[model samples]
Target: MVCGPDVSTHTIAFNTSFCHLRDTSAEADSKLSTLIHEVTHFDDTFGSFDSIYYLRESRKAVGTERSKVKTNADSLAGYVVWGEVFYAS
Candidate 1:
């Protein structure tokens, strides 16, 4: 999903895939997977969550992927894309 963010409220306008995932049955595996991916975006945009921290927690694979993405640290989209690559659902 490509999230459109509103800096005013720190909200993301979910793209089609995200809306589909959210509207689906909560117990569905795909929904859970989407939740994991989207939550990382949400938290990175609106909360104190840090991608590097979680990447470290996910161990070497995630950490290695994180290293490959060039992020600005202040760019939400960069972080989101990085997470999608390193910590995909």
Candidate 2:
């Protein structure tokens, strides 16, 4: 839980694991992916972040499902992996 909208606190702590990469551009930050992925999980019953719904998406076999893969954002959970800047699912 390095990316923390820490419970009972007013801060979101980012995990800087990608900071050491030679690609210092913002696009190189891995957190961008995680943020887009988890943002889709906000469709939960409470309209908030929920793992139950997250796991449910992982079970979808129709086409694009959610877990932790970079593809599309609105339909799955990711930004465009090719030729684009972002996506959300």
User: Which numbered prediction scores highest in TM-score against the true structure?
Assistant: 2
Residue-level lDDT for 5 in candidate 2: 42
Per-residue lDDT of model 1, residues 1-80, tens digit only: 64544445656565676556543322232444344434444444443233432233333334454443333222223234
lDDT of each: 0.39, 0.36
Off by over 4 Å in 2: 7-10, 20-29, 38-76, 79-89
- Residue 70, candidate 2: Cα error in Å is 15
Best lDDT goes to which candidate?
A: 1
Clashing pairs in 2: 73-87, 73-88, 73-89, 74-88, 76-89, 79-86, 79-87
